[model samples]
Target: MKFLLIGQGLAGTLMGFRLERAGHQVEYVDAPEQTAASAVAAGIINPITGRRFVKSWRIDELIPAARLLYTELEDFLGVSLWHPQPLIRTLYNRGDLNDWQARSADPGYSEYMEDEPATGRLPELTQPVFAYAGVRHAARVDVATMVAAFREKLIAEGRLTSGVFAYDQVPALLGADAGARNGNPAYDHIICCEGWRARFNPWFADLPHGGNKGEVLIVKTQAPLLNLMFKHRVFLVPLSDDTYWVGATSENQFSHEEPTAKNRTFLADRLAEVLTGTTYEIIDHRAAVRPTVKDRRMFLGTHPDWPQLHLFNGLGTKGASLAPCGSQWLADYLLAGKPLPEEVDIRRFNQPLR
Candidate 1:
């Protein structure tokens, strides 16, 4: 089958790769600047979260898939993108420590959680009363580099087009059963992976998209680059060249995608709380809206009315971990006669377009 994948962000890029690998032809159309949440994201895949010591949803399935996919990408692209770093989760108080201890005792948490407490402290951070715990098998992906490399390869193969996709022209361009031609080629399916912009897509606009805007800051510190990710109220991820990625506020109510002074101040204040006695220079600030959903589940599957149209989006904050597995599942469903997991199928809405 031939496919036209819209929006070459993380979701679309991964999906296109999967479909192509599964013996299908794919062409991508995307405007990178407008849909850049994946590029700006910190891309950390830590399995444990929250002060209450809860494990992330479906982390067991998500992590292994990520490890396999990123490792494969590294070899395929001849570039390094995966960093298997541990996470240092500092305890806020006695309750937080107790919660960690209890969660650690559970056998299921063995793979992601450490049973022992962290021994040392960073000279830059104030010592917590109960110290910190480590979450192993945590990792970060270089999203920007990965996406750029893949897109460049696609462009070289003449399989990608860089431009704004005019939604109104979609049906006219791709309405026939024999498929519609764009210049020289015809496509059998059109998959929408428009990220937060899906809210404006007429076919998918009513799918309960509760998008959230997130702002992130890139800062450089003189301190030696740490090998692990650190977290308290906010995350501090170490990057190349003694730089760190700090972020991100989940603001459901926002005016635009531009970074605001208010969010800058908030991130600065939070950074000061966790990283003390460390002098850092602000390198860059970026903001993008994520395709979050009201139910916090991804949107996958064909449109109820248009069988040739499909959607693969709403991985949201967990896109780094979710995209690998989600894309494969979508490809399987499209290429084979597999059914989409009920939790992520768009058909769950039970409403068709008018």
Candidate 2:
């Protein structure tokens, strides 16, 4: 089968990889000028999250799939992509510590929660916090690098169209069972993976896409702290050497997608609070909209009215971990007539979100 994927962000990249591996031909129509959420995301896969510290949804299954796919990409692209690191988060008070201890004692949370967290350079680099807890089975993914490498490979193979793909073009592309038109090949199926931009799509716009904008900063710290990811007021993820990926202020209501001076100052202030005595120089700041859904589950499956049109989006903040397994399920359903999990199926939304 021939599949044309819209947008070459993380979702599309994974989807295309899976489809081609399953013996299908895949091409992409991407707007390189528009910033994708994947490019700006720090791509942290934390098995334990939130103040209550419950395990992420389907984390046991998600982690292995994410690790397998990223490891495969590293070999295929000849570049480093995945870096496994333990996570260390701040415990604000005695109550927080008690909660952590309780969770760690549970057999179900044994693999993800740590009884004793290893504090590497944290003590020397930052001010003393209330306490620290460790989370196992955590990792950071270089999403921007992976997507860029894949884009170059796609361009080299002539399988990519680098331009804006308007919805008006869909009819022509899908003309007469998507047969060849004017010497141009037609696709048997078209999958939309346009990230936050999917909210504007005429076909699936009613599906209640809750787009949230996030801003991040790349800074070079004076001292190196490389062992673990720290989540204080903000997440401080070590990228390489003394450089760290710091960020992310989520805004449900935003005027535009561009990075603002307010957010830059906000993130820098947060970094200062966490890093304490450490000095750092800001190298870059970026912003993009995440493809979040109201219920916080990924969107998959075909359009109710059109079988040839599909959606693989709404991975939200956990795209790095979710995309690998989610794409696999989508590919299996597309190729082998497998059923999609009811939770993620688009049909769950009877009417559009108002």
lDDT of the structure predicted as candidate 2: 0.90
10 residues in a row with least lDDT, candidate 1: 176-185
lDDT for each residue of candidate 1 in 1-354, tens digit (9 for 90 to 100): 889998998898788877877788899999865748988898999898876677888889998999898888898899899998878877767788788888887878867788564534453454343567888878999888889999999999999888988877666556543343435325678999989888888988778887899998899988665667888677888888689999888899988889999999999888877677568888898899888988888999887666778999998888999999899888888888688888888888874422
Q: Which residue pairs show backbone clashes in model 2?
A: none
Model 1's alpha-carbon lDDT is 0.83
lDDT of 2 by residue, 44-131 (tens): 9999999999999999999999999999999988889999998999998999999999887776798888766888888878879889
TM agreement with the true structure for every prediction: 0.93, 0.95
Best by TM-score: 2
Candidate 1 to truth, TM: 0.93
In the order shown, the candidates' Cα RMSDs to the true structure are 2.9, 2.8
